[model samples]
Target: MAGETAPLGPARVCRLPPPGGAEERVTELCTALLSGFQRYEQRIRARQYMDGLLRTQGRKSIANIATTLGAPGDEHRLRHFVSRSHWAVETVRQALTAFLEESGPASAWVALPVSIPKGGEHTVGVSRHLSPDRSRVVNGQRALGVWYASERVVAPVSWRLELSDDPPTAGRSTGGGPAQEGVPAPQDCLRELLDDVRRWGTPGPPVLMDGRGEDESGRLAALFAGQVPAAARINGWTPLAGGHRTVHGRQAVAALDALSPTLRTHRRGRDGSPDRRPVATATATVRLAGTGNRSRQENRRLTLLGVWHEARREPGELWLTNMDESAADSLLSSARLLHAVGDGWRTRGAAVGLRDYEGRSLHGWHRHMTLASGAYVMSAISSSSDQARSSGRSP
Candidate 1:
């Protein structure tokens, strides 16, 4: 449905807490989410850890959490809970999905690969990579997350770690071996994750990726062929022509940079400021490279949505989608939903110390990230619930 949103059902209401009873509500939430733990002690430990993690003043290190909660054995027990506990992460995964379903239906799925810079080499899967934030090379571990997003919330539905072929220093091992044994490439991890998402049903929204994954359109298109529609940002100068004339061949940057501003739009300013800018958009049918069929080099026509900002002279942003112009425009034009994915990352980092994981084991990395995702989902739900109640609407 282009330019249209399905009407939401009666909003689900979160049971309110009594006056001065906010902690009880949070505790209740924690218990429900931690019920996935197989052992009763595991459940208790998980709850205690979450409570302190949220209340802890600084980085969510094991020592800080242990000291803040005054738990026995300081960081030892807490460390065991995350790095050595036998609780199955899959159980928590299912619980999180169930809670998200109860919150509301999702409008889209965003796949973001997060890069966490690490100072030590002992961290599992830590490898040298070009850090997008740092603008230079850095040692880091990369994790890919597929998040479900609606107008009110965005939460991860699936996650995978990118493994490098290089062997880890002593005491460090790859989190999990790839299917084939040797270290798996990042693309391999993405393919497997996308396949897993395909099996996850309900609120099945289209998937969106950033410029990095968009460059691998061939494999991505083949993987999702005729099942789920996909959209991605492409660099300018991607061999698009305005007309069928053979001489019209030109890069996306050349084609879009020449157009004048045709639309004006406003975006919320950072730091509570207001900002406005002149913007323009144009739609065209372009043959994106790598979208050709394998049987032969047959090009598949895709709707190309181009957005240009007067300030950024280069290609502002180019979106390639299988939907018609109206549908593609409706889905990606505002671009706010895209930015919300980054917001999810920021919230996790500030509130939960998303980058402070201390374990070096493969399972430990997965376990920590899984719990972090749960914490983030709950926070989003609570925030939206408060907003709904304040507005005199159920949520």
Candidate 2:
């Protein structure tokens, strides 16, 4: 097996000694989990990069990884493997989806966000835009990504880079090549990404979003109608409940602000003590915007839950969701999910070089994100399995 002719040019392969403990587990993971890459050479290259990403302390750029692995000569080869290769990223994503179905938590929320920070404009999709937090303006790649959260797990499953309006004009010039065609607007991109999940036969969960816009017209409600329920943070000024109750005519935040003070209805505080802050909840059916080609507004009955803290002097939090009257329960779950997603982002960036890519091509971005996501899930599953083993139980 050491000298077999392989798909990648004329490189000779060597078999490693049989493993015993951690090495064996990692080797098995590299082989079994990444089986979607059919070609042996592709698998080898992928594992190599993943290993480097896992082992290197910081900045998992191709050159850094190549140097760390003492294979400086393979830098160009690995770069080509990521940017110019024809490997199917979709297959790996499908495998991820399947794996989640087998050992994952019950679907709670599908939180999607549409931006990642970048330093320069040369890379594909890099443009000037408001940050996702909307705290300031920044230059970055516009990306639409889907993250799934259950009781115990949160991980990114799909991503699309929003191509800038001014894609590189020239063909394969020195800089990062031209941007790929067929990039959709951010809203449309979310639908496309969700459609991919549908194609995988995955069931829909509540679409949780923050900071889309004033949902007075309920455009998002119409968009996700009949597919899955949705939860979002609407602009404070959006109308609700036909102007009847306190929550009807006033801005969403103001309505919640005027409610009588009550203790928080959700879980205990981070320190395991009961929260004493005032909270409020309400429900209403708002009108949604048109769907497809129709210009007419559609009616979508939704629930609104709000919590106000006297110390804050404003509505501390608000939610608009189409879940049952128990929208408060879903809000609690979705809030935990939102927190988990933030933690996962930090972990991915630290453990697997989520933001360390130096490649500039469209394919490169997708390939990097796919591998990074796989690495993240693999680490999570492996850790979970080890814990179960220590406890003498099956995972």
Candidate 3:
């Protein structure tokens, strides 16, 4: 709610002229997103649903959207299209990935975990889970969102719902039921997302993952060993094979504690201020232990990175990377980009109804998310165009 803007409403929808207005842009985006749809009516329905998402005032329920757009007898039709439609969600996502690649190449791929709260018991993948910040337990749907991110923009391109181990409900075939057997670990979900990205034929970019509270650095690094470069936040207690005097394995924090810290300054501020913050950094060559059953000779060599703020007594953050020659500044920049993606999700994502779905089926939730992602991309591109116009340059 902090970064939200007033709704556009029906009045604004009515005032936009044809050929070059925001409505026209929405039409173009929908056409591109759903080009694989076989039926013309499906495309039209998708456009209408997306329009409602962008212009409707309050919650983006099907009934609310239909009523806000002044479309009589459309609530049922839209619900059917979302819940029981035969179209493939993967097709729409592929088109979206293509559109984004053509718009501008992304600098990195990010895996973002989100928690959507629910009041009822029947929604797909609904269960008690930790909040995004891991503050407290809440009843919600846990989802992994894969994003293509750059300094200028960030948008979710694919999503995966984490199924709960709760017993299957009677007659439910779509989601949170017998269709999926058990819940996958967060690292498994991230691996599946990366596989999807690779299958889309997009350029492999360095992956940035949030491993703040978990000690999955070895497993996460193994995911990108021979595929693409990666940097993941590592727990201080993660075991390492090198960077210590003893032959025994040592913790990441202990390895850094044995080394000298290098002083560095960060120029980019979170609030866009020019002030610089001096940071102490250190690095050591190490190998992550317990990745797999590989022998010591087969284990991949990794760089253990440690950073300490002037105010903190110990290292504030630890990271593990497969990029052996990566500089400390570059890895820190990637960390900043990770924060930017999170901010974009909290603000732009909320505005486009990222968590407003009211469906009970797995396919329905995915369809709604696909449309919401399109709306987010369109809004981001439109805002960028407006800024370019105001600055007397090309969009």
Best by lDDT: 3
Give each prediction's root-mean-square deviation over alpha carbons: 7.4, 11.5, 7.2
Q: Enumerate residue pairs that collide in model 1.
A: 12-395, 175-362, 237-251, 237-252, 237-253, 238-252
Model 1 CA deviation exceeding 4 Å by range: 1-32, 72-74, 119-121, 167-181, 201-203, 213-226, 237-250, 253-278, 287-293, 296-299, 311-314, 382-395
Worst 10 residues of 1 by lDDT: 1-10
For model 1 the local lDDT of residue 324 reads: 66
lDDT of 2 at 135: 39
lDDT of 2 by residue, 47-71 (tens): 8887778767767788888999999
Task: State each model's CA lDDT, in order.
Answer: 0.58, 0.58, 0.66
Candidate 3 TM-score, C-alpha based: 0.80
Off by over 4 Å in 3: 1-27, 119-121, 167-183, 214-222, 239-251, 257-275, 290-298, 388-395
Better of 2 and 3 by TM-score: 3
lDDT at residue 55 of model 2 (Cα atoms)? 69
TM-score of 1: 0.75
Question: Candidates sorted by TM-score, descending order?
Answer: 3, 2, 1
RMSD versus native structure for model 2: 11.5
In order of appearance, the predictions have TM-scores of 0.75, 0.75, 0.80
